[model samples]
Target: MLPRRFNLHRPDRIEDAVALLAEHGDDASPYAGGTELLIAMKARVLSYAHIVDLKGIAALRGVSARSDGGLIIGALTTHHELANHSLVLERLPAYALLSANVANIRVRAAGTLGGNLCFAEPHADPPAMLCALNAELVLAGPGGERRMLLAEFILGELSTARATGEVLVRIEVPGLPAGTRAGYRAFGHLERPAVGVAAVALPLGKGFDWRLRVGSICGRPTALAGLEKAMRGLPEADALAVLAEGAEQAAAAVEADDDIRGSAEYKRHLVGVLARRAARAALGMEALAA
Candidate 1:
């Protein structure tokens, strides 16, 4: 099957791209990487009369350092590029590992981070890890720019907070505090994940600060607030104990969906298992229990 005929507009500047989308309104969509958009169009799930190509916009590419020791990643960056970037490897190796393992080589080579987030696929990977890292997003539009946390940006499955004319410009990640460690783990039968978990641990006085996020099975990446609170400010041994005891309850509390991926109950079980493994991995231990 083929997509319906549509006009392609290649815009070399952000302003031009924004104007094209704003003018076309619901008839247009910003195109980058095309890993998701092209597939949907071919399947007849979505149609756009005007496709605004953003690859010509030079400003929407590359990786740079933040003065605060974090990273500023261009929205158009490919998964493969991010997986191998020196700064990304040095500052957020867990995220790099996740990127390197996203889908397969072909997707990694062509899929853009911006496109993945904008597509808001429930079984995607980056959103969970980025949420754990407390990443912020910048969206450009005719009215100017809007900034929001990645968690807030994703409203539901295949939906985001982006207005019709907005373009995701760059993603900003805050510097992890000293003694912080992060890890990610996922389980899936094929190219997409069924369940994915991300954990972050930071030393706080005599205890530790913990952040845990579960994705893929849910409509949006979900933070395990109850579990985090139970483990926060506890000694390493105590925290691990709390995690072991509370992981299942926390996973069960999440709002999940039953689809081709797996049943909601089974996906919830994977979340508990992955959460433990991710936590251990973050603390520099083996992911599997002996």
Candidate 2:
């Protein structure tokens, strides 16, 4: 299969890129590493009259720490770059670990985090971790730039909140407050995850407060609210024993579909298992109980 014929536009400026997209409307698409968009084009699932390349834009590349101790990652940053970046490793090790596990070597080399988020593939890894880690997305358009939470950016399966003529400029992961740790765990039979869970734990007096997310099994990364509330301030043994059943019930609450991946029920069950394991991993307990 081959992509339909299209004009390729190399825009050195973000303003020019936005102008091209605005002019071409639905017929134009932004091109980054092309790790996700090119595949859809090749498969004939998506088509475009113009492919606007953003790689030449100087502002869309690099990683730097914020004055507030958070990190700002450019939209063009590749998975491999983040996996080994010293700043990411030192401040957000869990994010670095997640980056290292994205697809295989070749895809990681060419894929951009902005593309991954804009593609909105449910089985993709970054969104889950980003949601759990409380990351914010920066978007730019003709009207100018605005910031939004990752949760608001991801609307549904294969969809995002990005408006036409807009580009994802960067992503900002806030520094976790002291005593908080994040971890990610996932399960799938194939290259992408079928069920993935991310946990950010803030251990306080006695039990712990957690931000837990279940991805892949749902249309979007969703918080396991019931299970999370139940596990609050509880120790490992108490959290597991008390909330194990709650996890299953919480899994039932996610929006799942029965496609080539697996049955809805099967994926729902996996969410519970992965959530428990991921929470335990975040808490530095045995990953999976005996």
Candidate 3:
């Protein structure tokens, strides 16, 4: 149950919400769908005397296509909305499918993508995919709005680069390049992921280009830059072998911790296994329909 004496302020305007946050400082926290924040509060892990309810802000909802061919999702857009959106399914089926499978139906009903990303939970799904797609985040603050890479927005477990007085207003996913394919692989039990890998392959002239990221092993998602560099220009069979080997090496590159999820070494092995699978999926060898 929520604390009996805490104050609630409903702000329909972004500027007003930021002003309240500026006034209350650490005492104030923004409230979205509250799927994550409220649970933490009820567990006594976090306490805020002032809750700045942002659900009243009409501007922070919906999806639209940008002229650049990117997709803009509002901060208030729920997991359910995005998962089933026609345009999302049409343009970025990989992302649409990922959104569809986030947690359970109940959590998807109450959780907002903005909340998920803003919370920066390490074990969640969107971060790795966002990183591979080179997504951008739009933040609104006292100075107006600014854009940041989704990769930079998430700093660590339950941490983000968002300032106290700023709010993430939208997520921008760039248009997929011609002949580019994307895939994501994750393994978990009890609704918590142990390892998640994302792969994107682009056909460039006479060769293939790859982008890979390994997540849920450490505090932050890690890109496999070395592996991508090595895979460049390799033939089909050669690329598969290199991806497998690189997956093992990718494990070493991440600073995974030994926690209840699994041992560090065990998690590293999962990264390799999933990386190969994800690579195949990205290459359209083993594809899933949204």
Best by TM-score: 1
lDDT of 2: 0.87
* lDDT per model vs. reference: 0.91, 0.87, 0.85
Top candidate by lDDT:
1
Deviation (Å) of 137 in candidate 2: 0.8
Per-candidate alpha-carbon RMSD to the true structure = 1.7, 2.1, 1.6
Q: Give all TM-scores, in the order shown.
A: 0.97, 0.94, 0.95
Report the lDDT tens digits of candidate 2 across residue range 1-290.
Answer: 99999999999999899999988989999999998899899999999999999999989998999887889999999999999999999888778888888899999999999989999989988888899878999998889999999999999888899999998899998876677777888888888999889888877667678788988887789998887788888876787786577888888988888978889999998888888788777767743211
In candidate 2, stretches whose alpha carbon ends up further than 4 angstroms from where it belongs are: 286-290
**Number of clashing pairs per prediction, in order:** 0, 2, 0
Kindly indicate the candidate among 1 and 3 with the higher TM-score: 1
Q: Cα deviation of 180 in candidate 1 (Å)?
A: 0.9
Pitting candidate 1 against candidate 3, the one with the higher lDDT is 1
Candidate 3 residue 29 C-alpha distance from true site, Å: 0.6
